[model samples]
Target: MKKLMLMLVSAAALTAHSAMAKDTLTISVYSFAQDAYKKALYDPFEEICDCELVIETGNSVERMAKIEANAADPVIDMAVISSHDALSLAQKGLIAPLDISKLSNHAKLYPAAQDPIGNNMAVGYTFYASSIVYRDDLVKIKSWGDLLGKDLAGQVSLPNITGTQGPLTLMMLDKALNGGSGDFSSVIAKIGEDADDIVTFYSRSSELAQLMNQEEVIAAPLGRFAWSRFKNSPLSFAWAEPEEGQAGGMNVMIMTKGNGNEELAYKLMDYWLSTEVQTRIAEALIDSPANKDVVVSDEVADNLTYGADLINSLNILSPAEIIANRDAWVEQWNAEVIK
Candidate 1:
């Protein structure tokens, strides 16, 4: 009958449509600002590539563990993590070197961001300046030494040794106390001596911000990326510029080893690092742009760690140094600072 013939044709069309759906591109990233990322980058990328964007979010360590566990069959097609974390993955052969030629926007990145880890395993996506965040009404943080000073005793929170901010904090504290010799033992000892005075050693910036908002703490060292939480708050807060200078670090994008999705992955990465997308992300205050061509309004710039001058001024820690010293640093930290 004519009705049966029409039904058969409709069924065939549905099957063909289902078969023609685009492939999925999986990405692992930090658990911060996903909503803004969705609006500014992910949705647009998915549309352009005609692929489903599968996002997995967590802290760096957990995501790294996931990639390592699934090494034989990668669950994540691509990722964005701290440069040091990416390097760690590279050393273990857990990630693949990016083909710069595939990323059309790769040439627009700052020279420092172009090959931060040097193995082509990753490329920088954003930079952050680290320093103290203090309640302006309650504390006067003139130097990194102020964290251990008697004035803010029992009212300060320090980043834990396991986190990125922790080592940067130690670096500044080392400079403050020992004139930047790169040895943080004395700095750890000083914190150990003042252990009881410190409110807690926080792992997440959000945790630090919460404590400050509740008045449980007056000051804590944090990354510029997290400044918006406190800056927008009803309570007064200030980002301190210490005599030792601010510490800086970069986050990078990488491809998981043998994920079998290189072309689509590169397409997404390229789009994410392009001037147009980077500018939008900067405008949303989700990240400080790594693409040098991105220009934003001053009002938007105020919320970001923008400009080459400030980036150059930062006392950046080398990813190699962090990797080489981290284990020993954590061991020393637990024995001294936590004891």
Candidate 2:
């Protein structure tokens, strides 16, 4: 009778534990990463957990608005967002503080990328750096100064103020030509001088690509991701070595606050941070691996912005500062440059 009772209790606890292991995790990510994520992360993780994955894709503004709207009763478990967006949400207290110790692969991440903003608000996924894309056959633009030439009038493309490229390019050029190193306000003067030559400032990388393909533009500051789509083109990408170096942004993963799905979300975040996973996904997608320990094949490594010295030279901006000043910068941009 005692043996039977013990056996019955063990069986009941096992069933209860099995039931507690939720097999469904919904994640939000950029539309750009949708295909690669589905192929690499979603499929593999689902197979491992014997769970179902529901992926939602959108731009930063739309995704953030969704989270804010659903804060009280959150449906999204985990989100792959920009560090700027992460910082914005963190400031609003919409994201829960993550326990780094709980992550199975925390040690695999780049030391600087672990708690990217220093407040443990978000974890860096990958970084995007800006460079000059010019037609080698048609023009000679090796640095920021070449873009300012009157010969390229009506042929230059630029980033819209709302976009990361716009602000980063502005800062990069300012640090290059003007005496200033960090403050981007000085670069606007250079842009203002070449304003007449500037074509429409693009809000999307697609638009910038189109401009390049159509021969409506000669040179512009573009991200490393854009290079993948333009690999076969006659366009040449030159990493401009400015005094302050290249400017870039880090994409991060965020966990929403007060969500009942913290356990699953935490698990997914850990898996995403795993060096093996990062190496696998980043190589296939041409996105820079966020995990410092991740080692990729030579071909994929060539496609990415890599090498320790190069990465170290990258003057990456603080996502927190960018978000805090985003509105004001946009306003000022419109008032002065965009106008």
Candidate 3:
């Protein structure tokens, strides 16, 4: 009787361990705001799904390279990346089309978020407007053209051509100079012409913020997501409403091609897109909600890229356009601007 009872207990332990292993879900995401995300999104979703989230965090380029390296056997079940990066993955057949039927919150998303990168391969979870953030006390910025103007010349900084905001700044500057010409050769040459007057090409928003705070840079183009850094600063800063308008972009969520974890991944994605979670994230000021149903207070909205009017009014460069012309842009930037 003793031997039989011990055998039963051992088998039960093995079954419990197997269940725990099967319930785990792995994900990759940006390195920023992990603590805020845990409090707002990760912790709540973990409770609802009853699964452990094994998260991998890094820059989009590093994370995307990892996904590509492990394409034969995906380590990340799902990931959040810039829309252009998602499109690049979709083009490479590294990610699978989402089963929208499985997502209960699918209908809650803004139309632009629903099929951002077509074929349901990815869904946008956030949008951010890009514009110039200037020290209003020191100088006035009325146009994207002003960054290269003689007044702000030596005091202005621009994003590097390799960063996400790089192409956006280029697009807006092109609009300001030539009235929305898609070709950027002349734009690149123009920037090259004024490169000597420009302070430096910053790779991260934080670096630009630091430069501004020290009075080294008086004005620079930045994404709204980083507005809080300047908004709370002791220095007087202002967001620009340039004549060319605010340029914007979206970040998206994607499922790996064959991770064998769709059930749990879809569950988390649905919960994330739901109004409750989206509102929580927006309230935390971590990301602007892509779900149209999310409502936030005026104070909270001021810190985010919120509301239909502003979202609709943004001049967004398409993911297709970014991917198609990025190489040429970079090549010219190296030869002319950076040289």
Give the candidate number with the greatest TM-score: 1
lDDT of 1 by residue, 69-160 (tens): 99999999999988888888999999998899999998999999999999788998899999999988877888998889999999999999
In candidate 3, what are the lDDT values of residues 1-339, reduced to their tens digit? 999999999999999988777488999987667888999988888888778999898766789999999999999999998899899999999999999999999888999999999999999899999999999999998999999899988999999987778889999998998898988889899999999988999877778888999999999999887787788899999999998899999988999999999999999999899999999999988889999999999999988999889999999989999999999999999999989
Off by over 4 Å in 2: 1-23, 189-196, 234-244
| Deviation from native of the Cα of residue 105 in model 2, angstroms | 1.0
| Candidate achieving higher lDDT, 1 or 2 | 1
Q: Judging by lDDT, tell me the better candidate of 2 and 3.
A: 3
Q: For residues 80-106, could you state the per-residue lDDT of candidate 2 as single tens digits?
A: 877777878888889988888788777
Q: Is candidate 1 or candidate 3 better by TM-score?
A: 1
Alpha carbon deviation, residue 76, candidate 3 (Å):
1.9
| Location of the lowest summed lDDT over 10 successive residues in candidate 3 | 15-24
TM-score of each: 0.94, 0.84, 0.92
Off by over 4 Å in 1: 1-14
True-structure RMSD, every candidate: 2.5, 5.8, 2.3
| Sequence-dependent TM-score of model 1 | 0.94
Two-way TM-score contest, 1 vs 2, winner: 1
Worst 10 residues of 1 by lDDT: 28-37
Q: What's model 2's overall lDDT?
A: 0.75
